[model samples]
Target: MTGIALPSLPAEVVDQAIDWSIKLTYNRADASTMTAFDAWLASHEQHRQAWERVQSLGGRFAGMPAELALQTLEKLPEARLRRRQMIKLLSLFAAVGVGGMGAREVTPWQRLLADHSTQVGERGRWTLIDGSVLDLNTDSAVVLRFDESQREVELLRGELHLISGADAGSPGKRPLRVATAFGLFEALGTRFSVRLDQHGCRLGVSEGAVRLTPRDGTARVAQAGESWSLSAREATRGTATPQEVAAWRDGLLVARDMPLAEVLAELGRYRHGHIGCDPQISTRPISGNFNLTDIDATLDFLAQAHGLRLNYLTRYWLRVSV
Candidate 1:
């Protein structure tokens, strides 16, 4: 049901439907509340459409206890959802008479609502009206908002690389900013890469500079040849090479003493399904340049060179051991 294609409805109407769902399913609504909701539903055809789509979100959790659903939502390792986002999602689930969910599970629907998105193993690039170049890594989604007042890119998921260009609008040089779940990045005519995962948002500046402001921390300037990791609470500075910063642009993965498990995890982003590493070899240091275009060949190389075994449980599932 979550995968059902739905008719497009206005954003406001969708929000209303979600709110109504929460009130009706999660709370003991008074008669007035029910009456108002009924009126809203009957007021417009788009409202009905929005409710139909949002209600499907809870189909899987409909039978679970509320406490159990909440526990499941809290334990989603891959979602790395913030506390606020988690609460909102929980409410959304409660609307459809369920509760447990993860951001990863909901991300596909989000991408469907995005202005730009890429499928698994596929990358994307676009030239903005301001002449800036925007690139999306595999399975990424973003919304571009460029108006007279500002130019903004909202990163919904995965990673993005951008090269800032002069905005020659009437007001001139509208600030180019990228908004992620963790914080905001204001570009300063620079080339930078940003990745959002369960951990946080990682920023690598290859050229010029970028101003990084975590949601709860003070602002700071990140110069060229610097890397920063930002969470909701703070920002940590790090180092990265130019090659490493822009490697994905050239279809290469540069592993600088990276862990075997980590390498497999990165490769998994380019290919579908699961790639598992045995715990014994998970932390083994691996260093090499691998081609991202052909993930299977790289996995084969790693298996033969490192004296490991590849167990193909299915075409969509592979395990590396011994």
Candidate 2:
């Protein structure tokens, strides 16, 4: 048996193709639709590749929870929100333009608008159209767009905390939603946080209830003090410890017998520099509450209290030694 080969497309072209799909789906595509689309796909072999790349963009909508995506997408402001975003992008272009560097610097908002991402150690916060708030942890990114019928937020990277609010005018409308790497978390007027890691994703509910439905079909309900880790195929339930989860918001680092490697990973989120532990020492247990504002002091305390030594490869790279 032979496996079918998938087509490869350039990412930029793929993004443009998805933008075209959004325009077409929203009735923003002009009468030159077919002509323009055909010309676009015919421009080069890569153009066709790009079109094929985006052909599956709407696959999530097939048999998708319409009510959920609708509510989520509707929370985003109008397209006019792009104006401010574009201005930011223009500044980057101007800087590159002045520097005479042909290379372009892509802003987080542009990649975010086009369904891209943020690099390591970057955090962002955004307000939804319905007055809901979203906070993206370090290295996080999300895509948002609102239509007359819905509000939607698609997590592209890292973790995001969402606080859903009551619909200002439409009292009986569907609830907002957040889509992550592992599954969909439908916010029912609640406060929740979802984190995506290399292993999979974790969801922790702070208040109210959230429906956790896997992209593959299985579903579970998570309430306050509950947490679950989900992969594409399964979900495992765990107890939610709010102090551990919310510690970041308070500028503190709290861990409970977590592995040294994992502790370092969390610490990395608070600083612009790098921190890691020796692989042999990674399995060592770590437990403590350290202030994030002074990471050097935190590291110093770890060495004094835990019999560990901190080594700096460079100002930005750190590692733990025994």
Candidate 3:
């Protein structure tokens, strides 16, 4: 649907309106809650406008019954899923003044709103307030949470390389940690990289040790020169060498006699589209260091080196055949 552009609303106002909607509509908030909302609505005209826009947004949710605004959220998981729904609602609010949120653009809302993030094919490095160095891989997002208790990096999406700083040695004695969907990794003055995939979180430790605690499993210490795949239940050792694993930090993809299909899959993550190999050649061995800074050129080089033909239905859809 074409959006009707209205006067731009403040992000905080939109969020407040959404929070109120969630409490009032989904939570069955009490009379006292309603009274508080009333006072908030009357405090400023912008609040009223935000409410109107929220109501209008509800109308847009009519057909898509799964959205939080129209959901019977009482039946859903309370903590993580609830926050996920709220983010989804916020994304819808953001899409209002622009054109409708396209199907392809739905998943990146949280990433786009993160404290630190990189777009597709982009890599970035940053220094945290606590003097730590952070390197974000393509399509990555992270949020920092620092307090007296701990210094935490919340990996919302994609992969990251972190070198723990001296925050732990400070007066408050805060420990440094990284949180992923599967579990938390507490650093011991370590350098580590974490990548999230469908199965679980993949961790590569190069410097000091880190304590790995799965959400529902026992904690284990991952020592230097170790790579682990941590799911909610267990931590499995990975086979890749330390160099092959961390090569992306130098803008390279190191395929150590990796399968052709596997190579393509890794390359696909750095690009916009599907990169597939013919089934017959999918298991063929490929080995080399390729430049990730230019993916198309890398693909062309691979095709030449491997004697594979490239078929392109569109620039975004590519297939490799023998």
Candidate 4:
């Protein structure tokens, strides 16, 4: 799939967009090149939108490390690279825009056409066409690609709880499968939640069973009340109490003796911006059920109860320290 077109964008389109980006930003463009670029835009309405979106990527990198981003930018061919363009070029290198990337990150087109998606701090559930329910966690997305041959759901990001549904159109029960970058999960008439992270996927099963097939190794099956971590190479069986798995759906952030850093990371998902703690406090373990809907109030109360200081650099940047 490396050379193949992204599910949301054609290969030629991405190549052409990249070419245009380079011409306008990195390379000197003559009058003829400008005319040709305009002609390309006239050729397809999407080309114009692509150019706009590409030009808009630099601001996202403002917080990135200067040395790391600059080093990457210096490798580019741009003679006079602006700060914003550096980040935009970084995005290009990381396969953020257009295609060339994996299926984990949802493309712009996918989001526009996604049957169901959620924004930061927002959660939702969708009753699928086949009568099953798919619950989306905060800042998540999933795409449904069902057909006469198979029923499949692709997890783009974040987490989801998928309950197997009945497809009346099929003679037998339709096979329900969830796909992610780490592996493929096939449901055996059960209920489960899948969380996508940087390295792999975490799966929690409350009822029934699921078989996980890693990209490079043997498949492993977890029974009801079981959990597992799936990487590209293997599935490591783990434990996740059903309560912990379903707590988010109930508007609570439940952590049981989990490290303070991880707890903050979980809380950060429901709130905006940088939420962190001092290195000395990072290892502290916390256990509680906090409100998810009103996270700021919860954090404020917890700061008082835990004898911690809530530091706010700005409305978006927050830190909890002892």
* Backbone clash count, each prediction separately: 0, 12, 0, 0
* Candidates, ranked, lDDT: 1, 3, 4, 2
- lDDT by residue for model 2 (155-271), tens: 876677888866686655756888776688888778988887655778888898888888786888888878888787777797657546765656677788877776766766555
Q: Measured by C-alpha RMSD in angstroms, how accurate is candidate 1?
A: 15.7
The list of candidate 2 runs beyond 4 A from truth reads 1-124
Tens-place lDDT digits, model 1, residues 46-150: 876665555444555556676776676566443334455446656666444432221113336548878989887888999988988999998889999999988
Tens digits of per-residue lDDT, candidate 4, 80-186, equal 34565555566554443332211112234435657788876899998888888999998787889988777899998788998998787687777899999878999
What's each prediction's TM-score?
0.67, 0.61, 0.67, 0.68
Q: Candidate 4: which stretches are off by over 4 Å?
A: 1-113
lDDT of 4: 0.70
- Pairs clashing in candidate 3? none
Q: Which stretch of 10 consecutive residues in model 3 shows the poorest summed lDDT?
A: 97-106
Local distance difference test, per candidate? 0.73, 0.61, 0.72, 0.70
List residue ranges in candidate 3 displaced over 4 A. 1-107
